[model samples]
Each structure stands twice: as C-alpha cells, then as structure tokens.
Target: MSRVPRIRFKGFEEDWEQRKLGELADIIGGGTPSTLNLEYWDGNIDWYSPAEIIDQIYVDRSQRKITELGFENSSAKMLPEGTVLFTSRAGIGKTAILAKKGCTNQGFQSIVPYSNKLDSYFIFSRTEELKKYGELVGAGSTFAEVSGRQMGNMQLMIPKTIGEQHIIGVLFSTFDRLITLHQRKLEKLKTIKKSMLENFFPQNGEKTPKIRFSGFIEDWEQRKLGEIVKEVNRVDENSNAPVMMITANDGFIEQSERYSTDNAGKSLKKYILLKRWELAYNHGASKIRPFGSCFALTRAANIRIPFVYHCFLALEDNPEFLEHTLNGKNVENQLRKIVSSGARMDGLLNISFQEYTSIFIRCPIRKEQDKIAILIKSLDHLITLHQSKLEKLQKIKKSMLESMFV
Candidate 1:
C-alpha cells in the first residue's frame, strides 16, 4: 500500500512513492586538507565546515577558502550548487542547499539528489525526519557520525511527480525568504532601540544627552532612585491573578510558560502584585542581561510577580520612561558594585532594595519625560507587532511541514 500526505496542492492527486536514500540520490562525504600545508589554507574555492551550515537555507560562501591544490590532496570533493549539504558527524542532519559549488570538511555526508526524482529544497525542509533517522542508526564512541552507506540505507517518501516536488520546494523557499525578512527587521529595530537608549539619556555623569527633542535646553536634574521610584511590596493574599516572571527579551511572561505547568502552589499568595506599567527587578543573571534585568507590566491587567523580584512604582516620573532608563549600562554598572560574589553560586545578584533605590538618576523636566516615555513606548508597541507577525509566519510553516509531508 502507498501513503499520501494529509494536504495537497490543487490538480495533484497521487500517493507518495517510497525510496531508499541511495536510490533517490548519492550520499557523499568530505575531508580536510593538511593544516600544516600553507598552499591549502587560502584560495578562491568556497570551503565549508559543519559549523557554517546553520540556520541558512542556501549557502554561497564559506568563512575559509581553499585552493585547487588543497582540493586535489584532500578527500574533500566538489558538491554541485543544487546539492543538499548534510552534516553527518558531530551534529548530524544539519542541512543546506548549496547556492554554489563548494566542498566541506569531514563533518558532512551530503546528498546529491537525482534531478528526475527529488528536489533539494524539499529535502532540506524535511531535515527533522532526517535528524531522527540519523539519531537511530548513527553510532560512534566519541561522537555520532552517519557514514555514506548508513545515510544511503535511510528511506523517505517522495512525490511521484517532479511537478509536485517543485511546488513544495517553491513553497518552502518563499517561507524561508519571509522568515529571513522578518528576522532582519526585528534585529534592526532592536539595534535602533539600543542606540536610542544610549543617546536619549545622559552618559558619563554629563548633565545633557547627546540627542534630545527641540525646545528642551535645560540641563537634566540628578535625583536619587529613591526620589524617582518607590518599592512596591503590595501582596494580594487571596488573589487569583496569573503568576508571572520577568524575561530579558519578552518582559513579563507567565510563570507557567517558564516552568511548564503550575509550579507555583502554596507560594502563590506570597507573590507581589505588579500593577500596569509598574517595574520589577529580576536579579537572576543571564548572558543576555548579565547584571540582571528590569521589566514593566505593559499589559493592562495586574498580575502576581515572584516575590524574589524587587518591585517598584514610578514616583514623579513616567512609568515607561523609568522602566526603559533602569536597563541602561549606567544602572548595570551600579548593580555590579553592589552584587556580592557569594551570590554567583545561586545565579542571583545580592543587592538590597535600599541600596538599589539610593543610586542616582539624571532626568529631564516632566514634559520631556512624558515625550521620551511616549516615544519609547511606541517603539515597544511596533516591536511587539513585528514579533507577533514573525511568530505567526513560523507557526504557519510548522503546520505546513506536518500536513504537507507524509
């Protein structure tokens, strides 16, 4: 009996054919040239390693180049532009369609698909299945590696018609382009925000910022954190609000999302209540925010934040403005001085609320504060919108991968 995909494009109706990996394509391996030979090191040839084959759908260049003499001496062989470059050693099944002719190191056991039977993009899009198959059959004492023979022995379901394969390949190619576009936009927006944060505020004890709105010529006033914000210790003992924690990138997210299941039981009532636009300091250290992170509850509803977080309310300042300002390098420097070395064992910073509130902050007048807060808040909203679009696009591709493949 033959098998068919759950979903199909218009004007196509046929069960997918079963084929061994070798029948559909030739599986090949690569090797490195002698490192001591200077002749092999740098040349016009595009030479790739397993590490270079990540996230990208098509690869046209390599970090390091090799000469024709290098290729002749090594086990490495040229893979055509349309070949699917698969990493079969160290990290098996990472794949990319070669944008141009290239050769890789020993870490790859790439596939040269037959033009009449298989599509490169279609095969690359279904790397999850290949990864699973590699995991089952691969064996090595040091690190798992799939030989050419083992990879060729693997089986797959391929559409009988080359037309169907082309359609599927084109579909995935479009998806990849869209995902890459959104990702670049997201990164660009974040870069802009970083620059704005640096330039919009005073730096190095300077009274004036490098960039400012027109008609605001007065030097900024220096005020203690105690004067600009006050700690909020309000706990709702009987509250049914959702438990939350601060994430460096996403701000406040559900505690359940972090731990997967309701990890907060009897400790729920002890959680501090954070109202709209109120801030909380998460002292847990992560590479993204090494000195801890401050986040605000931008959502309209109030939620219960972990008691471990130092909660704060904006006093004589715009809430969003204060929230953005608290994450600056200046604040991180202050945090570094106060964080005890012993706290490193627990992945948490040790700094008292009194000491945190005593740090000095320079600020403009009320009108400028409101303007800065509104501008920053708008950027956050725009970022959230783009983020949502990117997530939805990814979800669509994931769903398509499941239903469109057998």
Candidate 2:
C-alpha cells in the first residue's frame, strides 16, 4: 500500500518528528480513595479503574466515585479533562480519554499532553496505537502492566502542528459515533424482547395475560411438556448424519462448523430428522431452570423427534413463551433446582427426560404460539443485524488503526 505523506499545517514540512512521550506530555498515575472512610469515598468526583475502559469511548462518567480526602490519601492524582486513561492491568491495553475531570485507581496511567504541542484527542488516538506496542513489550507476563514511566519512555512520530492532529482525530471520532449508535440500538432491541416476553406469558396463575393477540379468548391449558413433544435419546452408531455440539449461546450447531478436525469418525447411531419450526433443547445447559435448554429450529436437520433441542423449547406450554422465559431470572432459578449438580466444572448435570416431560406449563393455542414466536423472532433478527453492524464498525476501526500510523 502507498503511504500518504505526514499531515501538516500551512508552511510546515509535514514531516513527522520522533519524540518520547515524556518529552511531549506529563504521565501521571491514579490512586484510590480509602473505602473505609465513607466521607472519603462517594463524593462528587468520578473515580475510574481499568474496569471502566471496556467500551473504548471517551468516558464522561465513571462507575465509581471518590471524595477529595479519598483522592488525597491514595497515590492517584486527579487528571484534567482530556487526559488519556490507559489500562495497565486486568484487561490490559484498553485506553480511553477522559471527557470530564476525574481520578482513577492504580490500574490506570493518565497522559496529559503539553500545551499546543499535541491535541488531547490526537494523543488519545496515539496512545491507543501505542497500546499495541505496550502489549508486545509486556508479553510473556501473566499480568500485562506498563508503568507511567514506561508509557512516557516510549517513542512516537507525530505531525508538528496541532491543526493536522485535530483533523485526524475528527475523522476517527466520526467512526466512533457510528459504532456507539449501533450499540445503543442493539441494547434497545434486547429490552423490547424482554418486555414482550413478560407481557405475553401468563404470570403466577392469572387465567389470561393482560397482553395477548386481539380476539383470542380461549383460556390457555396447563399441560405436561412430555404430552406435546416426543423425547428421542436413541443414538445409533451407523448413522451418517453430521455430529452436533450444543453450547449455551447458539444452541445446536454442526460440530464440524465450530472445530477443525484432521480425524473424522462416524457415529454409530442415526439421529431423528428435525424440521423447521421444531423445538430443541439440551438437558445439560440451563440458564434459568435445569429442565432443559431450548430453541426453535430455523433450519432442517436429520435428528430425533424428541431431540433435546426441541424438547428444551417444548416447556412453558408455548415454545415461544418458553424461549423468552428461559432467559428470565425466575426460569434460571427453576433450572438450578432441576439440575442434579451444582458443579459446573464437571460439565455434567442430571435432568431426566421423564421429569422434563412432566413439567407443568400453561399452553396457549398453537396459533397464538405462532404469533408470539414470529414477533419475538423478528426482534431477535433486528438485534442480530445491529450486532453485525457493530462488529463491522469495530473491524474497520481496527484496520485504520493498523494502517494510519507508522
């Protein structure tokens, strides 16, 4: 790729100059206010630690607060607005610029740029670029850490004029805004789905939900899950079907798609074929209730009729209702009860098909189930789209960071 000439202001050569961070800026470390002294802790000042740097945006507020006494007691000092706060340990290398005056804990090293020599925004971006270098230097250690002195000692190339620095900062800031917008949309979509689930599903024995499809008056029936879906646990060794792996997130997916294998072996048992709209669940994975983990099949797969996948969804009288309920806190509590063991590290939990089938649920009519599923699925699709856009924006920023600086 052809390299663009270093940017510059009028009458300047535009050639980049190399300087140690210490020469261009003052690097300071943050201290923690005493937690024991209530007066020294929750005051007006925003207190930051490495934990607050995950989003990579300029931080206007912190997750914590400290008082003047707390600030004075610790090794940390207050950094002025526009100082760059970089994580030194625990999620090492993430960096953000402070949008308001605040103090941080020992896990961060704040950079304050010298007057007129470099724009704070430009230094923020450059510090981000330097973070990759810090990681390389800090490699082979269990906890990646770089002191304020180390950050100051690192050498960097920069345009001599502040005007050019501000321009580059503005270009990247636009991309950051686009990314943050998509992230907010994704959060909204999830909230909508949660609210709809609570509204549509019958709560604690009210004959009908206050919110339901218009004109549907038939009372939902309470039925055992086993009565609705068959449970197929037969594993035939001779079957040529694809091997499946189940995870908490995606539910069931082809094992081959998730892993690279030089050795492929055929399973002896054939799985019952599954069709679209069928529900599946895993007995092993439970977020709310240990009864089963469930999902509606979006694709056809040759599997069992009582596939753990569908059976997982078959709870809650309606599969759609069950899907949303599974993610709720109540369901999680029930799941904990159904599972035989609390040892997650063992990767084993006992939930019998018989017990699962007998679980009571308030079932809506099939038509209502279809409607609820469609609405929730549509929201899920929107969430997925926004998440994909966010990922793309992040990737674009990553590429630019790699190419724009030396």
Candidate 3:
C-alpha cells in the first residue's frame, strides 16, 4: 500500500510510494583541502562547511573559496549546481540546495539529485524529518554522526510524479522567500533603532544630541539619575501582585510565562511590587543585554519581581523616555565602567542602588523627551507586529512541511 500526505495541493490526489533516498539521489561524501597549501587556497571553487548550512534554503557562495587544485588534491569533488548539501557529522542533517556549483568540508554528505526522479528543493524541504531520522539512527560517543551509506539507505515517501515534487518545492521556496524578506525588514528596523539610540542622545562631552526634534534648540540638561528617579523599597507583603521578571526581549513578563508555573515559592513576600509606568532594572547581564536591561511597566497591573531587581519610579522625567534612555548605550557605558569585574554576587551585578542613582545622564526638556519616547515606542510596536507575523508564518510553514511531506 502507498502512503499519502495528510495535506495535499489542489488536483494532487495520488498516493506516494516509499523509496530509499539512494533511489532518488546519489549520496556523496565531501572532503576539505589542507590549509597549509597556499596554492590550494582562494580559487574559483566555493568550499562550504557544516556551519554554513544554517537556515538557508539555497547556498550560492561560500565564505571560503578553493582552487580547482584543492578540489582535485582533496577528497572534495566538485558538486554541480542544484545539489543538496547535507551535513552528516558534528551537527548532522542541516540541508541546503546548491544555487551554484560547490564542494563542502569533510562534514558534509551532500546529495546530487537524479533529474528524472528527484528535485533538489523537494529533498531540502524535508529537512526536519531528515534531522529527526539522523538523530534517531546516528551513532558516536563524541558527537552523533550519520554516514553517507546510512543517509542513502534511509527510506522516504515521495510523490510519484516529478511535477508534484516541483510544486511542493516551489511552495516551500516561496514561503522561505517571504520569511527572508520579513527577516530583512525586521533587521533593518532594528538597525534604524540602533542608529537612533546612538545619535538621539548627547555624547560624553556634548551638551546636545546630533539628532533632535524640530524646534528643540536648547541644550539637553545634565543630571544625576537620583534627581530623576527613586528606588521602590515597597515589598509585596500581601503578595497580591502577579510575580513578574524583566526579560531582555518582551520587557516585563509574568513569572508563569518564564517558568511554566510561578516558580517564586517560599520567598514570595520578599518580591518587589511595581505599579504601571514604573521601571525595573534587572542587573543580571546576558549576551542580549550585557550591562543588564531596564523596562517600564507600560502594561499590566501592579506586579512583583524578585528582590534582586532594582525597581524605581520616574520623577519629572517621563518613564517611557527614562526606560529607553537608561537602557541606551550611554547609561550602559557608565554601567560597564563601574562594574567591578572582581566582585560578583551570584552572577548578578554587585552594584548597589545608591551607586546606580549616582550615575549621570544627559536629557532634553520633558517635551522633547516625550516626543522622542513616542517615536521609539512606535518603532517598538512596529517591530513587535512584524515579529509576530514572522513567527506565525514560520509556524504555518512548519505545519505545512509536516503535512505535505513524509
């Protein structure tokens, strides 16, 4: 009996036949040219590594190129365009079709599809299934690895007609293109925000910013952080507030969202309670926010965070402006300068509330601050919207991949 996919395109109602991968494509092993040979380096051939196979549907070029001598001298064979480059070791099962002719390092067990039977992208779209299979069957004490023989021997259900394979491949290719487009837009927005953060505020010696709101001619006033904000010393003895945590992305999120349940057990009463529009600084450094991050409670009711976080309320300064400003590079620079590398308290910063309050910051008048805050907030909202859409599209693509292929 033949197997049929759970979901099918219009006018495609044929049962798919089970076939070994070798029947559809020739599985080929790859090799790397020695780095010591100067003559073998930097020629016309594109040489790829397992690391290069990330998230790309098709690879046209490589970071490293090799000479024809390198290809001939090493076990690496010149693969034709439209071959599916599949990594088989260290990080096995990453797949990308060759948009141009290429050869990979020893880590790859690439596939050269037989034009009469297989489509390069048709195999590429089955990446998740292939990865799962590789993981299940791979063997090694050091790192799980699947050999070319194992890859070729693996069985798959494929459309009997080559036209059906092309349609499925095209559908996924379109989805990937859309995802890439949205991802680029998102990155562009982030870059714009970074530029704004860099130029919108005054530098160390400068009194005014490089960029400013129209009609704001006055120099931004310099003030100590203590003058604009005060630490929230109130504790949630009643524990009525929802426990929250400051995240690098997504700002303030409830405790349940971070950990399936409210992991704040016995120390619930010690949690800090923060009202809406108030700010909290988590002095825990991460790669995303190296000097830690501060966020204003723009949404949600009064919430409790761990006592380790420094919670504060903005005085004359707008909470929105202060949130972005403190999280900006200017404040982060001051933070980096002050952080004592030798002293650390449980992987969190050992700096005190008093020290944080003493940090100096330059700010424009309240009106200008409000305007800049509005723009940044708008950008953040747009970013969030696009991110949500991208995530939804990815989920849809994942669902389709599972349903449309074996």
TM-score of each: 0.94, 0.78, 0.91
Model 1 misplaced regions, further than 4 Å: 259-262, 342-347
Error (Å) of candidate 3 at residue 304 is: 2.9
- Candidate 3 runs further than 4 Å off: 34-37, 141-144, 235-241, 260-262, 340-347
Tens digits of lDDT, candidate 3, 360-379? 88888899999999999899
Per-residue lDDT of candidate 1, residues 23-73 (tens digit): 988888888999999999899889899889888888999999999999999
Candidate 2: which stretches are off by over 4 Å?
1-17, 32-52, 62-78, 89-91, 105-107, 126-129, 132-145, 159-164, 232-244, 261-264, 268-272, 286-292, 301-335, 342-348
lDDT tens per residue, model 2, 1-406: 2223433335545567777888888888877766777988767889888877876678888877887777778887878888888787656678888888888888877788887887777777665567786776666577777777888888887777777778777867888899889989998998987788778877776566679998799888876567766654445545555555556666667766676422233222334455445565666645543445666656554543323333433432455556554555544555566767653563445666675455566667878887887888889789889999999998987777665555
Better of 1 and 2 by TM-score: 1
Whole-model lDDT, model 3: 0.86
- Among all windows of 10 consecutive residues in model 3, the one with the lowest summed lDDT is 342-351
- Ranked by lDDT, the better of candidates 2 and 3 is 3
Q: Each candidate's lDDT (Cα)? A: 0.86, 0.69, 0.86
